[model samples]
Target: MAAVVTALVLLVFLAGYRFYARYVGRTIFKDDDPNFVTPAHEFSDGGDFVPTKRAILFGHHFTSVAGAAPIIGPCVAAYWGWLPALLWVVIGTVFMGAVHDYGALVVSAREKGRSVADIAAKVISPRVRLMFLVFIMVLSWLVLAVFAMAIAGLFMAIPTSVLPVNISIVVAVVMGWLLYKRGVPPLIPSLVALVLLYVFVYLGTKMPISLTDVGLDEAASSQTWIIGLFVYSAVASLLPVWLLLQPRDYVNSHQLVVGLGLLFLGLFVAHPNFDAPAVRMSEEGAPAMFPFLFVTIACGAISGFHGLVASGTTSKQLDSLEDARPIGYGSMLGEGALALASTMAAVAGISLVAACKLPGQGEVLDLSWAVYYDSWAHASGNKAAAFVLGGAAFLGKLGLSPLLAQTLMAVLVISFAATSLDTATRIERLIVAEIGEAVGVKALSNPIVATLVGIVPAYFLATAKISNGAGEAKEVAWALWPVFGASNQMIASLTLLVLALYFWQRKRPILPLLIPMFFVMVVTLISLFMHLVSFWTTKNWTLLAMTVVLVSLLLWMGAESLLAFTRGREQPDSGD
Candidate 1:
């Protein structure tokens, strides 16, 4: 069953890429001219706007957009059932996620590599640009906070991942120096980096450094990790992309390919059966799967965040206009593959090992998914660990030891998260710069000032605590997580609105984008409204207020979009 699911997903994605992706690029967007100069070349500064190879840029884009969300989201959504999760990732990815990402990259490149929010100004109106900028600001801010918190927590849980994740930074720096300064060919250095990376993975399993070793207690250690991660974020965010961000992400992408390949091979060999149900209409304590599922599985299917990554970084690095088709559309399909692996690891891979958990229930387990996911709390809490353990078990079938396999999987997860952490910080700086320019804060346009303005709030937001109603304090970041998903999906919807308008004005095919645009907007809005009612009922004022603000932004963007279609339909295209 696991092997069958894997094969089917691969086939579908290939067909989508071969046919749908090509059509969307050629017919729908009117295939970009190769002779046109890209922003990467037009504004080359040995920094953010360095022109890059197609394959290398794809790696950076894929790893930046992927992060741990794809793995974590599907694992959590699997509580509803594997089938729904599978279907959403396959369909949402091809139609909405890829299209939105591709369109954003193409549009941004044409607009001189500005972000989607900036493109909104040209596609719609100036006021809409300010509104969209603020919306992206909040979303990117939360991403930095949430992903920082997440990776730091993972370091604590999977200590063996610590060394490898950190060392990759040094490796990336060297790789970049060689490629840019010494004019070294990428293939050999990247290959050597991969080997050295696995060596550290083995060393990590043996040494497994922790802040506790330096005398910090558990709580202090967690805080220390978060602080250290932010420091890295700041430095990486400020540095030249060739020095660290690009090469590091490039290495991390190769790691995922090898790691995912092993998991798929193991699935064919072990061929585990699903221990969870096929379609779970309702779980006892979980939210209804309808709108929740769409938001929960954001990265796998569709996400607004991908648009930020595409327009923010990838567009600035593109070698030519034609590269947008592959780097924008192709990367999302790669992410969809990762999402598929995550869903399988959750439902079928978990059943391959042997462990006992439910005390007093005589649930003497043989590593069954049913026992582990018997409750929503258990499944949700163990989302990251679920993938690591299950993928490790699958790899064990291929003769890797438990310790090595787990360490490798954990390192893979942390690497992706850390890549995103720094990338988001870099983009946050750009978003802050744009916001500052919009609001007339000239000082904030300085890169140093913008970096601080963007990342400082995320640190506080990551560590902010609120009452859990039992006199116990809990993370406000986690508290606002439900609304975060709604906001994220809402951004994707708005980006699609921008894309649809971009195509509508050009007299090109818009229905392909229009269909998914309406579907995602409706689903995310309904999801937000549901959470609004739930927060109101529970009297969670903090979350209620946050949701209210997001709702307002959605309405504002919707109005802007309507006027663009109804009143601004004759707006001329920004011809390059």
Candidate 2:
């Protein structure tokens, strides 16, 4: 019953978003005045901002948001039951992520493709700008650290993880050389690199790269990975976007579309019952809801992180105000769809396993329950379901036979993690450099020096694995969870805050900003309080560290907002 409802809801949501975005594209942006010179047009350069086809822009924007974090979050949160994760993905994306992303792009574009920090400074006040700057830097560092650890965890599980990643990187470098160095059109090498990437995943999975036996002390391994990822990010960020970022994105974009499509098609055909309960009530009688679920499923629903992407790169790529609706709002809808698919897979997988389990049997659902269930029941499903499920059931039934699908999933996730980690590191570097310059630290004004300084935190958090010990390593996951979620939520808050300011200053109806702003604030505050209480009660040093980081950030943001209020200014508008 729940499964049917979920499917219906997901379909309706996807279809509605498609209809709505098209309506917005046609009606709201009907003016189509190229000379009007909105922010995207204002900063128009042939490189990033020039009008490109919508398909290409969609590919770019989608890849920026599509990644393993969404899958991992859904999977983890589903342990509490699919209800929270599923409902949030639907509600939050529609109301929170979609609105925040679209709003950020529109606001940033209106401000001349300047960054969110810049807009905050120019329109709001220098103080607000500083807070945003600091937020960007700290958030970037934390994000880098989190993803670095995630990627390293994978590599640690399978040493051969490095092979596909290295191959993809090499392929990218070579493709960049061909397109940029040898003056070849991007399409040729881009396709080749992409094909080679899949081939590597296929072949590499069969090569027996499991290194679980040769464990590096978790701490040591984590530290090494953090430092290594920092160095990698520094180099990657410094490179021209054409070389690595753009090409990799091109490849990843296709992967997301194809991969997500396959998963959803399979889930529908399988129509597999969802075994997880509607809600998981904790033993203590708490609802096991609210703050925890909201924090856990941040990326799928309402990630503040999306604000950074919208305000940073996507804003720079918009061709005109018209593009903002699709690039921002449309892309978020895609993410929401992905989240729904993941939740379906989790539920279906869980259901299949629980049904087959014998009475008094040992626990049926382990951490890898989805993998196990898909391995068995995919082949056991009704002929109709199996046939309808298409390639998903075929792949699922294949188990470790083809090995390619598993490898593909693994490589896709790892590469996404690597790219995101590096990107975060670069953003941090830029933030530190900008902030240092603002504070008159002339010596730290060098981007490279600021980047190096930024890397320090990455190294520290990454290496904290060893120093904290194996036990501590696992615990940090929980402690850091809310901080990561809150940081992302705060980003959303700041974005909606900016949008509200924009509307307020312009005397436009402020309901859009007010709606999302209120929700994010409530959720984030609830999540933050839970985290603080958890940290203080446990007296865990890792949690303690995260608490300090959050506190300091809040303080800085408060001061910055106070400064903005004092300034009593309105952003200058050059009417188009």
Q: Return the TM-score for each candidate structure.
A: 0.97, 0.82
Residue 195 in candidate 1, Cα distance off native in Å: 0.4
For residues 314-413, what per-residue lDDT tens digits would candidate 2 score against the true structure? 6666666767777788778778876776666565544332222221235543323343323222211111111112223324643523245445555656
lDDT of 1 at 295: 93
lDDT of 1 at 377: 72
Runs in model 2 lying further than 4 Å from the true structure: 1-10, 19-33, 36-54, 158-161, 177-189, 208-224, 285-287, 351-394, 397-402, 465-478, 540-572
After best superposition, candidate 2 residue 276: deviation in angstroms?
Answer: 0.6
Tens-place lDDT per residue, model 1, 290-329, is: 8888999899999999999998999999998888888888
Quick one: best lDDT, which candidate?
Answer: 1
lDDT of 1 at 454: 84
Question: How much lDDT does each candidate structure score?
Answer: 0.86, 0.62
